[model samples]
Target chain A: MIKFSINKAFFLQALNATKRAISSKNAIPILSSLKIEVNSQSITLTGSNGQISIENTISAKEENAGLLVTSSGAILLEANFFINIVSSLPDITLDFEEIDQHQVVLNSGKSEITLKGKDVEQYPRLQEVGTNNPLILETKLLKTIISETAFAASTQESRPILTGIHLVLTNHKEFKAVATDSHRMSQRKLTLDHSSDNFDVVIPSRSLREFAAVFTDDIESVEVFFSSSQILFRSEYISFYTRLLEGNYPDTDRLLVNNFETEVVFNTNALRYAMERAHLISNATQNGTVKLEVINNQVTAHVNSPEVGKVNEELDTESLSGNDLTISFNPTYLIEALKALKSETVTIRFISPIRPFTLIPSDDNENFIQLITPVRTN
Target chain B: MIKFSINKAFFLQALNATKRAISSKNAIPILSSLKIEVNSQSITLTGSNGQISIENTISAKEENAGLLVTSSGAILLEANFFINIVSSLPDITLDFEEIDQHQVVLNSGKSEITLKGKDVEQYPRLQEVGTNNPLILETKLLKTIISETAFAASTQESRPILTGIHLVLTNHKEFKAVATDSHRMSQRKLTLDHSSDNFDVVIPSRSLREFAAVFTDDIESVEVFFSSSQILFRSEYISFYTRLLEGNYPDTDRLLVNNFETEVVFNTNALRYAMERAHLISNATQNGTVKLEVINNQVTAHVNSPEVGKVNEELDTESLSGNDLTISFNPTYLIEALKALKSETVTIRFISPIRPFTLIPSDDNENFIQLITPVRTN
Candidate 1:
């Protein structure tokens, strides 16, 4: 028999954390529901699609914790139904009890709901990543890095490995992440405080997003475990797993250049907002081109569509040097890269109008670099 | 020449109101833009999609009124581009100047944008509903009646006239609005404060929504005019016109019946919330089926899907009377109708399990009656 009075907050958190594993249209029948194992001290909920699995636990502790399990048992509930019902319940203590091991009932105040359940025997077993010591990392830094670079990954299947965020740990101290879709690329690097074996792995960008979403604000640290076939992330309240991409990642070190023919410096907000106005007319069929004309002390943005008319914005710049250059590019790529920048001002270096340009945050941003190829307007 | 210094708020309101008449993918080139005419007292803006035309004029009055046109002239500006640029400008005064008869410039603070213009001579003129005195109706009441009945109209085109809301004025005082899609029907009536001659017409539901959107909170009454081909709604700031449906509407007086074999009275919110929970498992293929079982003093909502499992809940009721009847329905139909009800307590009267039911608001509901046919669950 299983019975418990769980606080609404904890139950809702666990349900939402595990929901990323439940797809709207799960092709696998067994993957459409979640498994809940109840015990005297705590309760564990696990949800999984074929590619990833997430397990969350609510412990009985603190002055007034969210859960209290009296008896121990296990059962399966349809994920979508369980999520909707729990979300719509009143904001108070909720009582959950199992009857005959095949059904469940929930009650709060004047409302009581009974839902049919399935035995946990049919739930597929999750693979274990072994209990040996795993590499520990700060959850906040990892989450930030993922947000900075994962968006640059290729969404097309032509090059499967390019769809993953490649992580490289050199001599167990220097950790770097790189993502590219051939046209534009973003990379961020950091020095890990804890030492470990040298490792390189490419995790699919889609899985990284789901893994990152389950991190709570209170979860400062996470233990990372690695197998030949998959990567696992274990935290105090949650465990996440993701499939590894097969094949070698391209070496992007050669693409990072330190020299330039012309360089322009401008406040990130000023340039970004100006581009947005120019973007009103710079849509895709028109090549999404926004021309930047660097002359004297200003950089003017010009966008002209044959059908929609023209837009011109002269943006204020700090300094414009070297051979005056006029270049164009898809404004969307530069806008996103600039938005990810952490500095108030940014330096953009160009090598003629045909070669790719590099964006560097003024002395403030620590270890991230972005590059974009200019679209030829001439 | 048209030269004016206008504030951003007034300009935004006029642009958005007219945008509703401009389709995103209009085949006609002229229909994609808005016509702006400037005068000393007011500025007029017009947008039309051929099917519907909306004219909004901003007058100089009251504190911080929307417009103060300085000169007299007219031109057409691309709706999407103009709206986007004006919306992004800072909250301050903006200057508009016509130049060379074929171009216009907008200047605000440090930004100046030049856009090409079209001559008003080529613009299509809207058909006038004549200068004869039009009927006056309370904007709130008309909006309320439309909301209650328009949703029941058929969205499909098999029967063109059923997609309209039929309005009838009997004895020059009582006005009734009725809409039906064969499966369900809704009717609402009220006595006009200002008496008029007998009138009846069917207006397409799509056009009624656009006409209602132009109403402002301060405007209590709107003058309505009718022509053989169109209906016109004129307020202090806006004028809206729409084409009338060209067919005779079905007479629905015989469908309204009195007396019933079973009836249930409960708070509208209580039943609506319970049905929403039951909806998690109810959907169209299963007929969007949710069964309501009425007992001595309780009503239980039950939904069972073989693939997704079952859900059952007992709802609180004020009173349950007559023979016990178990009726099932497409919860969406009943939910929408109940949401439109204005009273706290709602009484549902049923003739039989297979017959249609009438929904009447307890005490506060005025002049509105909704009907829904129960789906036979075999």
Candidate 2:
């Protein structure tokens, strides 16, 4: 039997980290259990699938002196319930002991629970990535890039390649992230201090979403390791691994424009409010189009649905350049882009009636661009 | 053309109350619009179906010096979009004028909007209730009574009467609210200062829900006007009307037990936590039974689901009276009852295997009582 005591605070942190390790719907029963083992100085928790495994360890303390280990053993417990109980328990030493080959005792203060366990040998093995192949980037910057561009990725299962954000590192100094659903596109650019040989990868948006949850603002750098089909992100004490999406991304450089026939700048808040109002009725229709009419110095947004009626609003613009233009686009695309914008004023450029429009921050300091294709309105 | 200037704040508030007046999915187009009319002292907004209508009036203010009313007329504007636009606009004096027979102009500061309006004659008329048969109750007390008991009402549409709480005046000064779903039940009693003739009314849960949203603690008494088929709750500024659910309510007094075979008393916190843990897995099962085994000074809660797993928790009880009993009940009902409990300790009384169980505050306050029927486990 294996018996040991763990510091409640340290154990909770490690347990929460490994909690994400277990799959909610694992086909194999053994893969769902976390393998916990006690060494002299630390306790290791391993949760794994056949492809990916996460291992976390918490150091033991002096107050846990009486902790004894009769034999080294492994057990598997239900992930969801065990985490719920441990998180709610008061800060106190936790006792873990193996009563039999398949049973383990978990006790803290007045609470004692006995749960069935699985054999440790059934746990999947973790892949080893050489330290020489790691690339480092600021954690906050990485989080910002993911937040800005991931929402534009296609959620439909038909286009599996569009579900991944294409990341390209130019000479290891500048990084770019791009996501598109064919109709709408978003891109974010940032500069990195480290230089690794040139690299390119397509990480699934779902995995980046999970990484965003675990990332905090304080961490300075995150080490990224990539193998053929899997990528791992390592922060200070946590490592997140996800399977990479496989396919060739479409070439999108031809979709961008260098010049525009008309450019209109307006406060983000005003445009957002106008689109929100238009969406109120347009949302009932199939395409949900909102028409924007920009003349010399004014812009009017018009939304009409045969079933719900119509709404037309005139908004003050900061400035307008070039010839007059009329464009109709999906209001949802504009709303999402406005929600992600960080600047007070945004400049939208229109090239032609059939071409896509480009939305960029009015201030030149921000390196983000969002492009939206205009829908043909009847 | 109808023209008026009103305070945006007052307009937004009145608009909110009026928006709720329209039916969510009404067949008549004008029934889904709010009828607005400008008079000398106030702007009245009426939203109605054929049976019910909410009329809210915002009195003119000193700022009305600039406000102009050219003509007194009524127009119907789409409730959803109009409310959203009015709320998002900056707080300022708003100018509303009819541009044509079918369009209206809404302008405030630099923002101008033209919305298509429907003919007001198509809107449904508000039902008038006689003021003679009105019952008075404290607004706060009524809100509390509804919140506590309404959640237990049956959500199934088969028994329409069960979807409403039965409100009956036992004496001139005492009122009772009772709701049940056959399996679980909740009842609350309140004392009134003024005496009224004996009365009973069944108000739909939906109307009570709307009142809960708008009711505040500052108001003292709300006058309730009852007709043959509709009930109206009148506050100082707002009148709420709801269609009564037809059919006779079940007699639940006999379901209450006068004595118990065994009573188990325990701290509310301990039992609540145990039940919550058990509920995590029990929620997945059909009947979701959580068995309670009480012996000596201990209570054990056992919840099991063949597909997910099981949870067993032992709780220390203050004391147990009479014969030892093992009872199974829905943990969700028990959890909700415990949350509504006012006392720190709760005493549960058991009568028989298939009979209802009583859960009362340890203190001998008869104002609140909750009964839950036990589900037989195989």
Candidate 3:
């Protein structure tokens, strides 16, 4: 039997952290439940959705936790239902106790809730990723890398490998993260100060996104461990684990272009706003294309919808050079890539109208790049 | 030619207010467009979605408007598209000019948007609800009436008349608003100090909801005008019009009970929270029933879901009298009714197991009352 009382807000924080890994539409019935295990020193909450699992621990040493334990045990309760009960409790503190035969009682003020819990033994064991020689990554830097690349990953299930972010550590000093969906690709590279084990792994984009979100301001760094099939992101209070994609990521290094017939430099915000307006008009058109023209050192964007109307806007470009050219492509892809770049000034290089164009921050072009394949309008 | 220059934020405010009446799924193509009529002194924007129409005017006299009109004319442009263009413009001020046949050019800084405009002459005329003998109502009071009763109206369109809130002004002094969805009913009554023409009308619940939402904090009073087929809600700068629902509203006056077998008074907030928890549990059950037991002056609420779990909470009741009783009900209905009451203390009257119950504010029971028909559980 397990019996404990804890502060409501602290408990809720732990529950919310674990909830990111619990999906309601799980194939396994027990996977939809959250596992609560209590010990003398701390309390741990775990939630899993088969592909990923998150464990959050609150120790008794934390004063805000207000934790008191009479016995220690583990139980699994329906995640959403239990969350609702705790959220609506009338008091600031909650009392939890395990009764006979997989039943738990929760009390807060005058309200009492009795929930049927599943045996913790029935829950699938968390994947054990070996922790030896763990690579240390700055929490903020890792978050930036995930945000810059994960959105370019394929969401469609048909190409499962493209749905993962390809991560590589080369020469124990360089870190690279890349994601692509054939039409567009984003790559971010960072240099490390210290040496670590060199490894390459493909982590699902969803897991990377969730892992990045789990970081709080207090978590300075994350320790990453990679096994043959699983990867772990461990911080001070939370452990996020996900199964690695088994297939090899596609080779996209050759796709990066260093040559261009024309290049235009733009203030990122100005171009993004113009592209947004163009997108608003193109969204109503049949083909959803925004055409751009560079002439006499000036840039203009045009969107035409025969049924609705059209928009022609002179884009704010810092400078333009090389052969004047006109190109049309899907505006959504470029808009997303620009949002991820979050640069004040970016330079876009274009070859032919049909070739893929690349956008990189003007100050740091060598470290980050976004490439988009253009559509042939003929 | 129609031409004007105005502040973007001021223009967007007018667009947003008018956009409430424009639904994209409108059957009439022109109804999806907003009509802009500019005169030397003022600009009026109108949008209609067949069911309702809203017109907002911006006057040159308003300091924030900064409106300047070089010519006076009217045009109709796609509501959503035009709004998006103006919203994303790079500058604070926008210049609009009708260039040629059915085309308008809008310029803001370096961005220029050319849009196709429908002929203003083809736009439908606003319904003429006679403004003579208008009834004046406190905007805050009318808003209160809407919130207190509108939710009980039937959302299903099978019985069109039942989807309206029946409003009656009797003896030129007593004003009452009532709505019922057959399963439940809510009634609010107020006495007007000034007299107006006695009238009875049924306004569609959706229109009343929209009308209430249009009121900003600055609007203190609304002038109401009623015609045979349409009702108009007019404020200083906005005129809201909707067609009244045809057919007679059902008689619900007899449903209010003056006699009861059991009566329990409760602190409205405490009861509401308890019912909310019960609702959380009952929502997962097949029948969604919350049972209430009042025995020996103690009240306990119980919710049982065989598949999920159960909750038994001792309620905080002010006072309970009459014989012992056990009643099961759809907790959602009571929860909504209690929320609408917005009263510190409430008295709930029960007649029998199968009969309807009534909830009224303990302070002013006669002015407002909510009646809910209990579910019959054998």
Candidate 4:
């Protein structure tokens, strides 16, 4: 039997941390529940979808004054059902007691909920990556790296390895994240003060996305342990682990071009707004394709649909140079990459109308670059 | 050639009003475009999806300082593309000019968009509902009547007429809106200050809902003219029309009971919360079924799923009387009814465990009543 009391806010956080790993529909019945264990000084919750497991702990420390345990035991409760119940209860603290084989009774003020649970003995045993000295990463920086590159990863079922972002660390001083979906690719690099071993890993973009959401802007750092088969990310309150995707990432270093025949710079917001408006027309009539025409010092975007008619608008550009060119690409791709660039002004470099081009921040110090393959139009 | 300039806000409102009637995908290509006509004092915009047509007018009245039209001509431009272009432009006012054969150029600040348009002569003419003397209704009051009853209408495609609300007026003094999906029903009645002719019409709930939303709350009244096949709703700025259902509505007045065997009153908010929580558990396991047991002045909602286990919660009630009752019904039905009632306290009248019941405001109200049939449980 296990009994404890916890503040509503703390309990909600524990549930949210464990929720991401629970599969919406599971073949194994035991995997549908989140296993919760209460010990002398802490309450731990674990949930898994076979490949990815997440565990969160609320310890009985000064910082966690909301938690207090009277006895120690373990039980498994349906993840979504239990979360819904606790979320709806209105009170500062809730009392939890297990009784009658595998039944959980929760009480808060005048609200009492009795939920039938499963035996913890049947729950799956989750293995964690060894706790050897791990690489420490700034939480805020890591989150930015993932968000800036994750969406460019392919979701196609054909190539499983392309679904993750390729992460590379050299001398522990520089961090790089890269992803590509064949047509477009986004890459961001950051140089840190300290050094680290030269290592390479491909983390599933979906898992990184979920992990990033768990940290706040104030979180200082997260300890990462990378084993041959799995990776562990440990923070002050949560531990997350996921199986490493097998297969080598494509060598994309050669894709980055340092020199170009032509380059045009424009205010990020101005270009993004004009592209979105053009996208509005293309998305409805064509396959989200828009053409850009660069003149002396101006660029105009044009989209013509045979049935719905045509639309063309001039975009304000800071400067245009090199060979005057007209290029066509998916407006959505550039919009997303520009968003990740996170700059006031952006520069697009082109070699030819048929060749791929690179987009980078106008400030050379920003080590982020996005590449797009222009669509061939008649 | 036609040219006009209007404040961006005024242009946006006119587009939104007519845009609702334009189908997402229309078989007739011209239906995808919104017809714009600039007259001496006002600009009129119209869009139609065959069955429903909406027309909005922005006149040069003192109140409409946002509009200033210099030419009088009509042209048709793709609705979605034009709206998208106009929305993305930045400035207080936007200038519109027809150039070439059928090209419309829109300019705002430094942004200019040239969109191709179709000949206005090919656009289909919208028919209007005839009128002798139309019934006038307060914009606010009509909106309330539609919202209170629309959701109860049947959405099943088998019976087209059941998808409408039967609106009736006796001598224009009393107004009633009623809708039923066979299993559940909602009705609201109000006594008008002015008189109207005895009129009965079954208006599609969707059309009434759309028409009601187009009016501003401050509008004093809307002149409604009902024809044999269509209904016209005319306001100060918008004119709307929709087709009427041909079938007669079922007699639902007899379903309401004047007295009750057992009446239980509960705080609306408290009851709603408990029901939503219970619904969360039952929605996944069962067919959204929940059982209510009323005994000894307490009401307990219980849901049991052999596979997912069981959950039961007690809802606080103010007063209980008549007899002991164990009833089963979809919690969603009562929740929606209570929302429509919009009252502090609610009273649920029960005839028996298996019979239908009526839900009303705790304060005696003959103006509004909702009926829900109990589900049979083994």
Best by DockQ: 3
Instruction: Tell me the tens digit of each residue's lDDT in model 2 across B253-321.
Output: 888878888888889877787777677767767788888887775778776665555566777777787
Error of 1 at B287 (Å): 4.0
Q: Give the per-residue lDDT digits (tens) of candidate 3, residues A1-378.
A: 999999999999899889999998898888999999999999999999988899999999999999999899999999988998899999999999999888998999999988889899998998798789988989998888999999999999999999999999999998899999999999999899889999899999999989877777579999999999999989978999999998879999999868999999999888888899899889988888999998888888998888766888888778888998889989999989889876799999999898999999988978999999887776
Instruction: Kindly report which residue pairs in candidate 2 clash with one another.
Output: none
Mark the 10 consecutive residues where model 4 chain B has the least summed lDDT. B62-71
In the order shown, the candidates' DockQ scores are 0.39, 0.29, 0.73, 0.42
Q: Which ranges of candidate 2 are over 4 A from the true structure?
A: A1-78, A81-128, A281-287, A297-314, A375-378, B18-23, B26-31, B47-53, B61-70, B90-93, B281-287, B304-312, B352-355, B376-378
- Each candidate structure's TM-score, on Cα atoms with residue i matched to residue i, is 0.90, 0.87, 0.96, 0.92
The reply for model 1, stretches above 4 Å from the true place, is A1-9, A62-71, A88-124, A131-133, A363-366, B1-5, B27-29, B60-72, B89-122
Clashing pairs in 3: none
- Name model 4 segments beyond 4 Å from true: A26-30, A62-65, A90-92, A109-112, A282-289, B26-30, B62-66, B90-92, B99-101, B109-112, B121-124, B218-220, B282-289
Poorest stretch of ten by lDDT in candidate 1 chain A = A61-70
Error of 4 at A68 (Å): 3.3
DockQ (model 2, Cα): 0.29
True contacts kept of each: 0.41, 0.23, 0.86, 0.44
What CAPRI-style quality would you assign to candidate 2?
acceptable
Q: Write the per-residue lDDT of candidate 4 for residues A1-378, one digit (tens) a residue.
A: 999999988788779878988986988878889999999999889999877888988889946548889889999998988988899885689999998878888888666667888888998777758888678898988888887899999999699899989989887777888999889998988887777666799988888888887666666999889888788989987898988788999998889867788888989988887788777777766566898888776778888766555567877778888988889989899888877877799998999888899988898636888899999987
